[model samples]
Structure formats: C-alpha cells, structure tokens
Target: MVEIKTPMLPSNKPLIVGKIDVRVGDHVEQGQVICQIETAKGNHQIKATEAGTIAEILVEEGREVVANDVLMVIDEQGKIQPEQQSESNKEILTTVPTDTVQHHLEKDLLIIGAGPGGYVAAIYASKRGMDVAIAERKKLGGTCLNIGCIPTKSMVQSAHLFELLNEMDLFGIEGDFHASINMEKVLQRKDEVVDTLVSGIEYLLNKNKVTVLQGTAHFLSDTEVQVGSTIIKAKNIIIATGSVAASLRVEGCDLPGVIDSTAALDLHEVPDSLVVIGGGVIGLEFAFIYNTFGSKVHVVEFQKSLLPMLDADAGKFIEGICKEKHIQTSTSSKVISIKQTVEGEYIVTYEKDGTTSYTIADKVLMSTGRRANTNGLGLEHTSIKTNKRTGEILVDEYEQTNVPHIYAIGDVSSKVKLAHLASQQGCVAVDHMLVGKHPISDTNVPSVVYTNPEIATVGYTEQALKEQGIPYKVSRFDFSANGRALTMNQTEGFVKLLASEDGTLLGAVICGPDASSLIAGVTVAMTNGVTVEQLTQTIFAHPTTSEAIREAALALIGRGIHQ
Candidate 1:
C-alpha cells in the first residue's frame, strides 16, 4: 500500500501569502479558505488549491509560507497528490524493502543530549568508527539552542545594535534616528536562528549515521540506557545533560512577575522596570541589555562584588561602567521576600547594611546561578556519585565516572559552565574512551562575559596565584593609551596580565571594545603554553585593538612601547 502526502495551499493561483490556517487531518472542500498566508504586505486568504480532505499543514500560523514548499496534502479516493518533493519516496519505491531497510539500534557509543557537548561527541566518536546514537528530550539541539545561550545572545546583539545607533554621534555620524523594538519580531528572528542551527544539527547527526532518539534518557545499568522504553546497549555512554537557571527560595518567589534568565528571553512585552536578583554574569548581562532597551534595571547581589571569581579590580571597573549606564547596582543586598502588589507589580524586600528596604518593579529576574539537571535520571541505581552541595557529577581527569563504562562531560560535571568547554570535554572524553589514557582539565579555559565592553579572561586570576602561593608579576595596558581606541572613542577599559616571576604567562583579563575577539589570541597563547616573551616578539597590527595585548605583555617586563 502506498501512502501519499501533499501540502495544502490556497487556490488564489498567483498565491496569497500568510500563515497556515488548517491543521493536519482537517477536512477541506474545493475553494475553501484553508490557510492564511502572511506576506510583508499583509495577510492573504489562501483557498484550497486542491479538491480533497486536508491531509496536513506542515507549517504553523504566524510563520511565513513560501512557494514550492509543502504546505499540506489532499486525498481524492485514495489517490494522493503530494505537493512537496517526493524523489526520495520514489527511490524507496524502486529499490528498498520496508522490512529490509529497518535501522538496527545497536551502537558502540550513545550520548544523551544534543547540545554543544553531546553533538560534538557523536560527531567525533562516529568519525572514529564508533556506532553512535544520540537521544534528546526535545529538539535535536539541547537547552543552549532551544532556550538558553543562543536566544539570549541574539537579544543581546539587538540591544547592542540599538546602543550603537544611539551613540552614532560619537563617531561624527549625524542623522535623526529613532528605533523601537517590536518584541515579537525580535523573538521571531531568534527563533529563526535557533531553528536553522538545530536543523543543521539534525542534518549532521543523520549524515554521521547517528541514530537520533527523541525522548528522556535513563540509565538502565552501567552500560545501557533506556529511552522511551527502548533499551540502547552501548560499550560506553556520555551524559551531557546541561544546567538550568537556579532560583532562590524566598517569600512569593513563585509569583507570576518573577522569571529566570531563560524565561526572560521569551517575554512578549518589555517591562517598564526590572529588578534583577543576583549580579552574576547572567544577571549583569541581561541588565545591560534591558537597561539599554529603556528599562529601569536595578541589580541586587548577595556578594559584595559582581562576578566574584574575577579580579577585584576588574569587578570595580564593571561597576563603574554599570554606573555610567545608569544601572542601579547594590552589592551585599539580600532579598528577604517578594510580594505581589495589587497593581500587578512585584515588591522586592531586601536587607543591606543591617537595614531593611523595599523596591517595586514590573518583573524580577532570578539569575543567581545554575545547577546541573541530575534529578530523575535514576543515577542512584548506579555506582556513580555527585557532589552533595552542587549536585555536579564526579568525574576523573579523563571524564570518566565511578563506573568505567559511563562518562560525564558538561555542566553535569565541570566547574566551567561555558558551552565551548563542554564541546572540548566531549572530545576529550571520547578520546579517553578510545586511547585509554590522557585527560583534560578545566584550568586554562578562557571565559568571556558578553557585557557592553565585553570581558574575557583566561587561566589563573591574580588572586588564584596569590592563593596558590605562586610568585607572579602583574602588568597592565589601558585602552586610553591605544591609538585605535582613541580613534574609535571606546577607550573605557584595560587589559591586565599576570605572569610568573620567571616571565611564563599565567593569565590575562581584557575589558574593552572587541574584547571577546581580542582574547582569542591570548587564549591560544595560554593554551599552547606560550610565554610573555614569545607573545611580545610577535608583531601586532599597528593601530589595532589587538596590539594592546602585545603592549600589555611588554608591560609585564616593564618595557611596553605605548604605555
């Protein structure tokens, strides 16, 4: 028996463009308005392009419909006319038996989650001739794509663009410009980027012949995982389930106006004023974006400083910048309770310096930190253990768990929560499985904060050296001294370097324009164990922001050319 599938469309002939109106299995007659196509011009009524019951609507409403794409199908007395491409179906009709073409489920390596880590493991392991299977609970790409990093970054980009336009006068560009964000459109573009990338991941998984399962994964035992009751046996398993936003426990914490960092990304309307709880990376970054977007942002952090792991001086620099942006920041301010007002606002009560105070805002964002999603995975059934305080899985340098056959490589295990670290760990874990030795450490990994000026750091902080009793010399270069920064009118931050007494490069912090990109060269140097002398020896492009790195390195030895 042959099954036919076709996309339903309007009979307007020239084609009316709008959102899809009919759903799958919706019966339709000739010339019926089956779907609404939204064109940039406006919505257009799409009539039934065929005379039959509606088989399916492949796309959703509010989504643009394109020509030649399968919109839906119709069946006239079992004679199916599929409007979409059917070449693959014809090939299957000619050369393959349905029973014979069934995919065998056995795999040598099975990974759970397809975020940065899991997908990388699947690709790398598959390249090494391992049969790979990846199970994801939702979309092919995990939280980073579907909810967290990608979406938030896109919003940040938009906010930054708005900021740039607002400051165009500094560049001697004169124009009367006014722009307002359409929140729905901003979110639509983010969704588009995520959809494209997630679909790309699906393609890569299929190209690698990795069996993709869509369901929750659980450990059936040490060497096996169960996904939707399907037992997948493998020689080894990699658990890459990532972290989620950590919420604080306080009165009225579950109020409707309160949201996590991820939830803030999906908000339809921008709040008039937002109170951000926790001044960590996530909180500050969002605060910068929202402040730029015309929201009155007030940040409350329990710690005395922002980004506590960063250098104290660096934190001060960020505080200064936040002040310049008119963002209200309070450190050592602990929230005691959250109450919902009759006006639908959130009243946040807090104590600081032994005094209780309160503030009201349309919304409160919880950005304290993230904890690993280890619950409900049935890990208690196995010998694997997790840290009681943080719930992070215990893993050796080789990314191996207590059971040799199981490996963990992500927020589920490591201190570094960045996505790139997870991808690298995934590769290292696979290599350990194949090579039987060698492992990687979280040390020397570069961390970047995507705030206005952008902060990127790598290796040891000066505090770390002091704590470890490692003798180190400190050096610095200010963007105010750089010719490029002077020209760009962005001389607001500096680069600081910490090196050993013997001049071995230890770590560096960059806080300035293009800091995210500028740190890559320094990161590469640190990763390759390059020395300060080697870094200074390499000529940097003159009048470029990157030359600051070289200048900063030269300052370590007290011979910087510019400073």
Candidate 2:
C-alpha cells in the first residue's frame, strides 16, 4: 500500500479539508485531484503522484490537517492483499462517514453579499414573492457607494467647481477675491453623501421585507451556507462578493507613505506632491483631482498610452489635455521600486527607454487594477467553476454557474467591473430565475471615465472591430465646431461614430463635456438597434452638446449640416 500525504502549502498553517473528489474502491489516474484544502490564500488541490486504487481515507471533510499528514492509503497494484490489510486500515475504512446533516434555517433564496449585485438580487427576488435572505459583513451599499464611485465623483465635482472658479475672469466676472479649499469639509460632505445613500438602500430592503443577516458567509454545502452561527439553506444561491484592490509586489510597497484607492479616498489632507502608479481610470481620475486642487501630480503607466483600452486618438487627446493642465505623465514606463527618505518623502524609481529615472513625492497612490473576491467563499463545496488564472467565477448568459441553481454576478463573474453593470446583471439573474427568460448582452454595456473632460464609449470599439476583421466606416465631428461647446469655452475634444458598411450603427465614442450623460442616449440607441440614418433624421435642439452626436451620424451618410 502507498500513502497519500498532504504536501507543504503556500501558507504554512493547518488547512481544513474542503472537499474529497474520490471514494474508496475507485481507480485513480496519476495527477488526478483526490481532494482540496482550504488555506489563508484560497483552495489548493491535492493530486495523486502515481496511479493507484483508493484503499482508505484517513481524514474526513472539515477536519484540520497539516503538512505530511496521511490523507489516504492507495493500493498501487489496484488491490490490497488480505495479509497486507491491517486492523487499523479496516477501522479507517469503516469509521469514515459519507455524509452528515447540519441544522439549517430554510429560505427560498440566499444572497451571499450586500453589494450592488447581492442587494439588488435579494430585493428583486423578494418582490417576486420569494423568501430571500442576504448576508453582508460590511455596509449595505458595498464599495461603490461607500468608497469607490460616489465618493470619488463627489471629490471630482469639487475639483471641477474649483477649476471653473479659477477661470472666472473668462466669464466676464472680474473680482479681486480668492478662495481656498478645506479638505476636512470636503471629506465630511463625501461621508454625508455616502451615509444618505446607504440609509436609502437599508430602507428599500426593509420595505421589500428581505431579511438582512450581518455576518460573513461560508458555503457549507451546495445549497447550504453558514453566516456566523445561523445556517441558511435555500433552493437558489447567488455569489456577488465583489472585488478588492490589487497590490504591487515591489519592496517598500507597504511603507507609510504608500496607499491604495481605499486609503486615498479617506486622506486627511492632500499631499504637497503625489506619485500615482498605473495610468488607468482610478489613477488618472485621482491625478486630475489632486492636480486641480494645487498638488504637483505625476502619473506612471506601464503601457505605451494612457487609457490603453480606449481609442488611440482619444487617449492621445487626453494626454495633450493632461500636459495643458501641467500634470506630468510617463507612458511605456515600469516602476522598479519605491523608497522613503529620512525627510519623510518617497522616491519612486522607474525604467523608461532602457534608462532609469527617479521622482520624489510626499505620497504614492497604487492604482493598479482589482482582483475578484472569490477566495475563502468555500467554492469547492459545489461544482461551480472559476477561472484558474483570474479567480473569476465562470457563468452563462443568465449568470448561472455550472451548477444549475447556483449563480455569480458582479466583479466576481463579469469581465466589466462597473457597479451599474453589476446592478443590471442582478436584475437579469432574478428575471431568469423567477420569470421565463431574459437575456442581456454584455456588449451593450457602456463604459465611462470621469476626468476633467470625461470619456465614454458604447458598443464595439475601432480596435475591437479591426481585431475581429469586421468591415466598418468611421465619421468624426469636432466639438470645437459645436456652438454650445464653443459658447461654454469647453471645445477641446470630438465625437466619433462607427457604423457597418450597410449604415447600421455599430458604436459611439464621445470625449468632451458631459460625455457620461451623453453616452446614455447612444447606449439606448444601440440597445434598440437604431440605424445611423434613423439617428440622423431625429431632430436635436440647436446649439446643444447633443447636436454633436447628430452631426457625427449625419456625417456618416455625407449629409452633415455642421462641421
């Protein structure tokens, strides 16, 4: 007989047996998963080193085990001789239990988070007359309302107002007056906004009669979960744990002056100078915010362009805008290290063009993307599948996992991490479960980046079409020629529309004032399959920002009324 022992894990702690995939008397192949263990990081699979037949199981599910602990006995020759079978082996085989029933509270649906995805699903399911219970370890509105979207946008509005005030002379208002910013009040107002929204969500949940359980949820079985001491069993379960900010692995990343997006939102005061790593949406938004507030800001991006996912022309236009605002940007750069000096300043070392350079600042914000929060949810307890590389849960059009009744939504399963998308996905999942069928295409989702001049896009991008080899035509209209934009003195960007050879509207890209709100119309048009000719025929108010959209559509058919 050969012994199958647990190997050393990444975290050197006693791991609990999460699942067993094999049973006694079953033949196993080499490197086949026999079981899995739960650790501090996540689940780790235990595989057989050689082909063998399972003779005995030494550990049961939910038992704590350490390194080199014998998990099972496998007979290499596919059979255990009577002389080789000892009393201990027979006792082990006899003592192992196949299953156990734990006491649990019954419900119609159990949602495993209180974020946008979870709460939305609970409320929708409850409205359909299902007994729904939601478990959350933190606030009701999750990261978006509390820290991510609403808070940052509030700060952005403050910075925008400040910018407008600085240009009062251009608006024919001459004054010998000055204004100053008090970060304390700014933070207070942000907190107030968050609190009001959170209270509103709480009221909605109460009105819908959805039970709110305050605790962390762990799956004890496919249909059962334990939230603190209470066990919840439901016919359907939705996992929507959201995501956490990813961290850089370089040295000194954990220093006092270094911070993440969450820490950046709660700063007591803006630093004299700031170094932002990663030139993505979060990084650039904060860079513009701090720069508008009179801080020397520098953005470091590893890619060749800022907003690499956007159209190349749009990204270059924004880069020029950043330069005009005196915000420093370094593209095609890699950060090597960050160190603190004796004077309490941070030195960021990076490589560009095969040359090393350094920049000093009072604080460093690590705005590197985010990772799905799928770890530690006990996913191995069920047949639900996840991406091995990104740890994102795998789901179908209806957000249903491999297991029919189990579902995943939001950052945990979606490729797009926006909160609004999560809320929409939640509604779709509820419709699929209670109603007959409701399909929502992810391609119809819109994306927005709220900067000085916001950027928004919906439908297929130029790069995406080129990659897919789809024949397309493009039309462009500069906002500089739009009467409303020129009148407001905000004519620094343009609008571009993409359509198929047959004149079908494929997508729209807007890079100028109110792009966030303007994209809503484009999204609605695309969702309803509105053609370019139809859009051009629709009347738009004269001298308005939306006229730019109509102009672009008209230009597609060579009938543009404006430049």
Candidate 3:
C-alpha cells in the first residue's frame, strides 16, 4: 500500500486542518490540496504529492497533525488502502522543509511575535548562546504592552486612584471631591507607558545581540521564515503571536460604536454611558474603570455569574462591590443585537431569562474573549496541528508542537492566557529547546485578575475538588479580622483555603484589596505541597495582610488565632 502525505508548502508552517481537505475514498492526484493549515503567520492549503485514493483519514479536521504521517494509505494500484500510518513514522514524516528551506547554520533560533513570550523567549535563547532573530509585524511588546494588559492596567490604575480619592470623604476628609478626567492626558500617559516598555524590549533585544526584523513574518518553509522579502533561516522557531479579541457574533457587531477591548483602550474620550457585554475579567475591570470615570456602566454576562471560571465566592464579592459602586451587572444575559441610533448612540438589545430588553449607550464595549492569533502566517505549508474550535497550538509538556523543531507557547497554545503564564511558558519552551526539559506544570500555573478587588488563584478550587470527588476541608479568614486591613480601611475580602483530608493545602482564593498579590504565597505553598500545619507554625509579620493567609491556614485545622 502507498501512503499519501500532505507536502509542506513553501511557507514552512503547519497544516491547520490535518487532512481536512481530503477524505477517505477520495481520489487525489499529485499536488492536490489535501489539508488546510493555519499558524500565527497565516493560513495555507497543503497539497498531496502522491497520486492515490485516500484509504483512511487519520486525523480530524482542525486537529494538529505531524509531517510524513501518512494521512491515508492507498493501495499499490493507487486505490484506498484503509490503514492509518504508524506512530513511529509520524516524527520522521513531520513535513518540516529542512531540505528545501535553506538553513543559516549560525542562526539557531528565530521567533515570531514580540509579546511577553516572544521577548522573554528571545532573551532566554540568547542567554543560551543561540543566534536569535525576532520578526514582529507591529510594535514590540505585542498586544500586552501596546494594547492589552499593560495599557489596560494603566487605565485601571487611573480609575483606582480616582475611586480612592472619591472615597476620601469616608475617612473624615472633606474637600472638593469632584474631579474632571482629561482623556487626552490619560491616553498620552498610556502611550508613554507603551512606548517606554516597547523601547525597553528593543533595548533588551539589541543588548542581547538578538536581531529584530520589522515586518509581518510568514513561514516560507519549515526551516525558513520570510519577513517581507528577506528570508531568515534558523534551526528552531518559536511562535508566540499571541491572541486577539474574540469577535462577538451579535448583530451590528461591526458597527462603529461597538468596540472590542483593544479599541476601548484607545479611547481619548470617555463616553457619558457605556455598555459592556461580557462580565469576565476584562469586562468587569473595564466596567469598574469607566464607572470610576463617572460613566454610567452596565455589564451583561451570558454566564450565570460574572467570572464564573473563578471561585464563585470571589465573583460574589466583586458583584457586591460593583453593586455598591452603582455598576449594574446582569447575569445570565446575552446580547442579541446592537444598532447605531440616529442620535449618535448605540441601541443594544439583549435578553435575560428569555425576556428581551433594550438599552441605549454612548459607547459599547465587547469583552467577550480572545481567539488565538493564527491567521495569515501560513500554516498550511507544514504538518503542524491545532484544535479547530480554538485555533490554539497543540503542544506537549515540553512545549513541542507537532513539528519538533517548531514550538508554540503563550496565548497561541491556550495553556493559560495570563501574561505571567505566557512568560513562564516561554521559559519552559526555551528550556526544553535547549536542554530537553519541560519547566512548567499546568497545576503550578498562577493566574491573576486585575480588578478593583483583584482576583488571583493557583491550582484547584473547592468546586473542582467536589467535581473530582476529592475529599477536602475548607477554611476561611476575612480581612476585616486583620489589623492591617482595618488600618487601610479596605477590609472587604477574605482568604479561603481548601486542603486535602489530611490538611495539606490544595488551593486557595482571595478577593479583596491586593487579592491578586496575596495569591502568590498561597500558590507557592500549594505548588510545593505546603501543609496547613506548617503554614500555621510559620511566623507572619504583625498587622499585615499576609497574616490573613496564615490565619486562613490555621482556621483549616480549627486553630486560627486572629480569625
């Protein structure tokens, strides 16, 4: 029997839809498109080089598949053979164009996307003595420094400062509490922050002797990347193109006033009233920011609770805080349509519990989610694989994608969407590339939400424990019981710990002042299997917020002193 394998296109990226274009029992001639692939670079059509009938479709559409794995077997007569390719040959057949793509023997590594992961990867690779070149289509520092995390955090900080000042009256301070926001200045500050950080990345790259190619990069072959007209050949390539705002499917989603998270950050004028669709971290954070700026903000979430993926108690705390701020939150609601009104406003129609309603807003921000930025780089040229629903790169613990020489990390891999996680994953990918070791474990990944109260979590939750039928006990300590919280007048959160039956710390959640910051200690403890007993015996700084964590651990064994 003869096997038909998809040939790598001149663009060396992977086939997105592993053999999706071809089917069992379908006869294909040489050079016929057998599958479609996508990468951070772009999409491409992979053609079949063997003239034969597909005997079997080995992988599903939108699934990542490696090169040389016979997509299907054909009989000696070029008919269907009905057998799949063996696993041993999959690695050998991984259609990396090593031969066709000229290799710059000296350049060991090439990276795409200069986001948190890309820059970190380049730095680490250069440290390991690899000749590294990074190609970026847009500004350095990618979306986080430019449009997503950093800029948004700056805006959030501004809102936080404004909110704190407004609350000064509660502390017996009396003055003109009224403040006017100058969006131009705010935006200029954001620009300055982005520019400084981006320049820092540029400086880092140059300081490390890494080459920076400014252009949209596309895979010209498995071993070669083309940035504009120049082709960069490296033995290893890391894709960290990151992600973009997931498109909302509601009507008029493309309207001018209906903006995604990126556009929302670029605002030079704060709208009088804004409607945010999606109550996830981004939505709630923005809602609080805009509300602090004196904009009437309303949040609509399709889920039953805002930040449902987080600890339910944490979401409840934020919901209560948001309510106190007069920020309306509607859960179990979905946006049906959006239309621009004649009065230069947006008419947003949504449904809650099957009841339809309409709200008018000066601006509409959609914070639904983000998809992997895997369009345009041409993945169809090589045999790499991904999940169709997410377009996220499929990788092993070592961050090895279907193609061994090519690796994917960060948002593109969907391991974790946080910038910190992406940075860690970049290190893991580099470590594996350099020493054949995987440095990250999914359970050890920590995630932080930068909201008013700030949510940070690492490891499992009580709900996850219950779902998994793991025996566990819970303990809680409120910040109100902590001296430092009272002194700061910000005691609206608690630290809760879930432990194993024997009292080993399993996971924890904190929702209050610096919740995101406080989560780190607990996360490290959980990752290293620190027990509640050990945590209780440890000395804690007096009159500090960290004492709450210690108290929470002590509470688990019914020996909490402060709580």
Q: Please name the candidate that would achieve the greatest TM-score relative to the true structure.
A: 1
* TM-score of every candidate: 0.84, 0.81, 0.80
Which RMSD does model 3 reach against the true structure? 18.5
Candidate 3: lDDT of 228? 70
**Candidate 2 weakest lDDT stretch, 10 residues:** 94-103
How well is each residue in 1-563 modelled by candidate 1, as lDDT tens digits? Answer: 11122223223443343555566655555556766554332344445656566655565654544445665666644333565427874565456333334333567999998889999999999999899999888776677788877888898899988888877887788988878878899898888778657645765676778988877888867766777746788889999998877789999889888999878888888889999999888899899988988899999999999888787767888999999999999999999999998889999999999999998899999888989987777787678989999999999998898889899988889888888889999999999989887578676788888899888898888888889999999988999999999888799999999898777888889999888899889888887888998898998998899989999999988888886
Error of 1 at 505 (Å): 1.0
lDDT of 2 by residue, 150-232 (tens): 99999999899988987789999999768777899889888877865775576578778899887788898898898876789
Q: Model 2: clashing residue pairs?
A: none
Q: Which ten residues in a row have the lowest lDDT in candidate 3?
A: 97-106
Worst 10 residues of 1 by lDDT: 1-10
